[model samples]
Target chain A: MTSRDVLFAAVGLITAAAAVLAVTNRRVLHAGLWLVVSLGGLAGCYLVLGAELVALVQLLVYVGAVVVLVLFALMLTRSGGGEVDTSPAHRWLAAGVGAGMTVLLGGALVAAYGWDTREVAGPGNEHIGEEIFGTWVWPFELLSLLLLAALVTAVAVATTGHSRDRAA
Target chain B: MDLPLAVEIILKAVVVLAAFLTLPLAIGQTEHKVMAHMQGRLGPMEAGPHGIAQLVADGIKFVQKEDVTPASADRWVFKLAPAVALIPYLVALAAIPWSAAWVAADVPASLLLVLAVTSVGVFGTLMAGWGSGNKYSLVGGMRAGAQLVSYELPMVLAAASVAMAAGSLSLTGIAQAWSWWWLIWQLPGALVFLVAAVAELQRVPFDSPLADSEVVFGPYTEYTGLRFAFFLLAEYAGIVVMSLLFTVLFLGGWSGPWSDTLGPLWTLLKAALVAILILWLRIAWPRVREDQLQRLAWLVLLPLALVQLALTGVGVVVWG
Candidate 1:
């Protein structure tokens, strides 16, 4: 394998391992930090694949903002110190569903693309921008609207009882 | 005569790391003397002639002092946090445009790279506080993270406006685009950027995270010896980085009447002026309350930044 391929493989393995660790970690704070490691590894994979802008965005949004948000919520709520138990029934159900989905998806991917040797298109900043604004404009706009609605709902929920006290 | 690219990069990285290691001495001493003069005190007068060797003496002391950790502190995280805090500044130093042809890396997205790497330092500060196992340190880390999040919005928005104006994301490109000093044209954006930059550095009036009066040096309280020294050095290095960024983004970087012949001198002069200005603010202002800091960032600076971005976008379309 080429050096680039080796690098990608290494990063992908790191991402998968971190993800698994994040799910199984006992302490909530440790789990959150493992998720950061997983996200950071995914960003490294993107960088190795020559998607610099996407890699940067992943680092900025996921590693910087999302991880901090998770940690902040954990700390602020005083829930960072607890150890969560995994019951046998829940573990068995999760394992069954996960294995089934992985098998189905892996089989479908091999059937569809195993015969092809064509190179995949690497998406750069300009290409991604054009695709989003041209072909996927409606979906992009709808997603933004959904996020806005979520934000407004959060604000409303937070202030529901505060106005009465303020008025008094 | 050509060196391999890997070798070239390693050499450059070593040079940048050496510079990062030594910069705090000169800069820290200058800050001490400047603040001392302002407050009518002699700072570090006994270390050497006019305290010239004060930082060197301080460095020796840091190395010789016994390393100590609290009984409750997490050993590994406590050890790793200072390196995390300091490495980003060292890495970002590689991409800085000291002058034309002087930067170690002139990547197309150097500006974004610098911002992204430097933002990770917040994680370091957070880890330091959390690993200390002190309630005060944890609260300090939380405040640091919140402050970083609040200020980063306006800082990025202000930078985006500059990128729009210059049509490039590289610091060297930004410097080359400004035939006239950019400060005059983008004064509003520059002002917003400077304010947000101070908040980003957690300087006075925006230093609730490290407020000695409230939290006892915040994250550094549980630290001792070389570890505390690293945190202090990181803060000084941050001041230097921000000063260089302000010079590059707003003051027309490296471009003076004689820059063609003088080269990096112009850039150094402008950056020094910015650094002194930041020190002036530290001496002049008192610390603001945490609530006021958050309110000013969200309620005031964010809106101003958005307006500046819109104006710059319009100017680029109409005037360019």
Candidate 2:
């Protein structure tokens, strides 16, 4: 394998390990941190694949925002001292299912694509803008609307009746 | 005779070394002098004119001081945290286009790369807070995380407006397109971006994580000596970077009144002006309450950014 391929494989291994750690880590906060590592590794994989935009979005959204919010929620819940039960029963069964699914998906991907090398097309930024605003404008707008709704919901949940609590 | 790769590497090394050594000192001196003036004092009149060497003295003191690690801290992550906090700010300088051809690496998505690297700086704060095993540090780190996340969206949205207006992700390309400058057309977006930038750097009014009275130095409460100095340097570097970026992306970059004549000097002048403003804000403002900070971001800035984005989109379609 080429050096790039080796790098990709290494990144994939790191990502998988981090994912496992995230799921199995005892501390909720530590697990959340591991989730950052896993997601960050996945972003690195995307970077290796030459998807800079996707990689950056992954870093920005997952590392910068989502995991942070998760940590905030963890802290706000006031469960800092509790021992988290990370281990789940039927671990062998779950691993078996995961391995099977991975194999099946890998088989489907290999069969469908057949090692056909395609040129990566023109500059990504222009293409992304065109794709986003031209053919996918409706969905793009819909996503924004949904995000607005989610923001409203978050604010409502965070602020409602808390103003009174502040004075108390 | 053709120069070897090593020679080029040496030249680049010299440039970076010069910058790393000199820029921080200059910026630090400027901050102290500005802070002194704002506080109605003479401000660092010794060590050199305007106390120019005050930062150097501070640096020496920091180096000579005792470096202590709290007993309760996680040794590995605690040690790693300050370096983590500082390195991203240095890496970010690589992507900031100083002039038309003066970028360290002219990557296709330089802006995004800078944002990604700087985002990792937050992890340093988070790890420092958590690993320190101090409640105050934990709270500080948590506050930093929340503030960074909330402000980041509005910051990204503000950047997107510029990207849409300029039709490029390259910082230099964006700067080159500023016939009228995006700041003039996207004033509201620029304002939102400035505020978010301050919050990202955890500066005044938004510096809840470091609120002395509230959190007692927050994440860095457990850090001492040079390790703590690194965090302070990183914060200042962040301010410098954010101001430079604001100059490059929106404020006509190096294109000033005398841009045709004074190329990089013009850019430096503009960036320095903005940096001065940031320093002034830092000294003049008081720390905002955490909840008020969040409310200002989500309730006010986010909607303003969204509107700015919408306006930019419409303007682009109509004018481009």
Candidate 3:
């Protein structure tokens, strides 16, 4: 196999491992940490696909912002560092559901699509920029508004009547 | 014989490795000296001719120091966090156009690529916090996440204004389009971008995550030795990256008065000047409260950036 193939395999393995860690880890904080690994591996996959922009966004938004916030919320609420309780019933049910969904999705994907190894050269950044600014301006503006609204909501949620709790 | 792609790749890799290896040491020394002067103290004067070897000494110290993991920490995640943090900064270096033909990888969407890579660095911080299993670290990581996400909107909007004006997302293309740089025409966008970029990098006045007095070193509180050093290096690298982006997107990359004679050197000079300015700001300013930071980003900067976007849209339609 070519070096590229080996690299892809490594990335895929790491991603799978991270996903498992995220789900199985008893500590909520540990789960969040595992999420970073999974997302980072996904980003590497994007890089290998030459979707540099998408990969970078994956790093910046998912890894940098979303997961950090999740960890922050967890820390603020939790008293100390220890493995969070995960009862056997919940674990078994989650494992079963996860396995079933994975199989179902895998089967559907394999049935619907050909396993072509051909590479596709997608549109460049300039083209995307043109399309975004020229044709997709309204949606772009809406996304900004949505983000603004989310920011406001976050502030409201974070700063509400739990001032004493937060301070503590 | 036609050289194998592997050989070419190795050669390029070496050059990049050398540059990365050297640049940080130089930049760190510069920062120490500058910070010293700012504080009215002689910094690193004893190391090697005005503290030239100061960074090298620091690097050695970090390496020699014991790398520790708290017994309560998740061992694997703790080990991985530094690499996660360092890689984003390194990958970001690929998209930055240092000079004409100087970019490591001139991806079609260089600007987007940079934003994306830098964003990933946040995950590293998050991982460090979470994996450390420290309350302070987790709180710091969360604050960083919220702060970055909130500010990212204004940052993207500000960048979009330039992309709209330049009509391209390629850093090189943007630089080339600067018959008159976008910074002058879109001063408001430039202002917003600079502010947002600083916040995005989690620098002072906006570094609620590392508010040492408050958060007790925030996400990095649990880290020590080389791992902690990596985080510090990543922060400096981030500052360099943001300064370079500002130079490229708005300040006209390497375009300057001495462009004809100085060439790429002129660009380097300009970039260094911008980096120094950022460092100066870091020294001069105090940290803003977390709530105030969010409020400023959403209520003030975001709206201002939107207005800038509107103005650009008008300008584009009218001028085109």
Candidate 4:
């Protein structure tokens, strides 16, 4: 294997390990922290696989925003010795879902690429912009519209709640 | 130019590490003396010739002091938080273009890299807050998280305008495209970026996280010695990176008289000027309340940044 393949494998391994740790960690906050490591390692894997823009965006959106937001919520919750649910049924269901996803994704990848080594170009911002705005414009705009809807709903809910408080 | 890849990487890393170590201390010293003079007071004048070595003295002290972890704190996370906070700025500094050829790593989309890495640095504060097991730290962390998430919108929008106007996502490319006209053209966006950056750094007028009277040093309440110093160093390094990034984004980095020969010097001078301006801002402004800071981001900076973005889109279309 080439050095790039080795590096990618190493990063992918770390990402998988971190993902497992994230799910299995007993402490909720520690689980979120492990999620950060998993996401970061996934970004590293993306970088090694020659997807620079995707890797950076993963770092930005997932590791930076998502995990931090989750951490923020967990921090503010003021948990007084709250235990994370570790029931056997929940664990079994999570395992089944995880296994099913793994099989589905692995099957899809095998069906599409089938271990065939095909060289792909490293993604630059310009290329990604063109692809998104050109070929995937509808999808991109649709996603933003959804985001806008959520934002408006959030503001409306917050404001109405404040007004109710004032009225009372 | 033809050196082996490993050797070149090592050299570049060493240079980046050297700058990463010194420049923040340099900026810290400047802030001390500059803030002192700005307030008509002598600030640490005895360290070495107008307190030039005050940072050095502080460094010695920090190195000698004990690294304390509270009994109730999460050991690993607490210990690791400072490094988490400091390293991202170092990585961002690496992506920053000192001059045309003076950068450590001119990644394909360096602006994104810088933005991504700096955003991740927020985890440092969050982890410290959580790991400390202090109520004040938790509150401070929540405030910081809210402020960061809110300000990030305007900051990214402002940056997106520059990227659009320059037609490149690379920091160096932006610098190369920068001209005197952009000083006027990008003024609104620049203001948004400056405000957002100051908020991001948690300095005066936006330092609710470290509101000592309210939170007793906030997330840093329990940290002592080297870890605390690391947090302070991280803040100073943040100033250095943010100022340099600002220079690259708006101030026509390395573009000055005789810049062909003195390009790196010009970049440094411009960045230093911006850093000093940031220091002046801390002195000139009073601390803002948390809600006010949020309102400023949403009501003022966000709308301003959106207008700047639309204007930039029109300008890019017309000018291109």
Pairs of residues clashing in candidate 3: A56-B116, A57-B116, A59-B119, A59-B120, A60-B119, A60-B120, A63-B123, A64-B122, A64-B123
iRMSD computed for candidate 3:
2.7
In candidate 2, the residue pairs with backbone N, CA or C atoms under 3 Å apart (3 or more residues apart, or in different chains) clash, namely none
lDDT by residue for model 1 (B175-289), tens: 7887664666678778888888888788887899999989987877898889889998988898888888888888888888778767678988898888888889999999989
Q: Compose the digit string of candidate 4's lDDT tens values, residues A1-168.
A: 889888988999999999998898888888889899999999998898788999999999998898888888887776522457788999999999999999999999999999889886677667888999999999999999999999999999999999999999
Measured on C-alpha atoms, candidate 1 has an lDDT of 0.84
Q: What order do candidates take by DockQ, descending? A: 4, 1, 2, 3
After superposition, candidate 3 runs with Cα above 4 Å error? A1-10, A46-57, A79-168, B1-4, B257-261
DockQ of each: 0.61, 0.58, 0.52, 0.90
User: At residue B313, what lDDT does model 3 achieve?
Assistant: 93
Place model 2 in a CAPRI quality band: medium
| Top lDDT hit | 4
Writing each residue's lDDT as its tens digit, candidate 4 over B1-320 gives 49999999999999999999999999999899899989999899888887789999998998999888988888898899999999999999999998898888988799999999999999999888888978898788889988998998899999999999998989999999999999999999999999999999998979999999999888888998899999999999999999998999999899999988899999899999999999999999989998899999999999999999999999999988
- 10 residues in a row with least lDDT, candidate 4 chain A: A76-85
The order of the candidates by TM-score, greatest first, is 4, 1, 2, 3
The total of clashing pairs for model 1 equals 0
* Candidate 2, B1-320: lDDT as tens digits: 56797896677657755665566667788888778777889887777666777888888889998988888876767888899888888878877877886666678888888887888789889888877979999899889989998899899899888888888888888888877745568999999999999999998989999889988999999988899899988887887788888988888788877666677787788888888888888877888899999999999999999999999999999999
What range of 10 consecutive residues in model 2 chain A has the weakest lDDT sum? Answer: A78-87
CAPRI-style quality class for the chain A–B interface of candidate 4? high
Error of 4 at A111 (Å): 1.8
Q: Candidate 4: where is the Cα deviation over 4 Å?
A: none
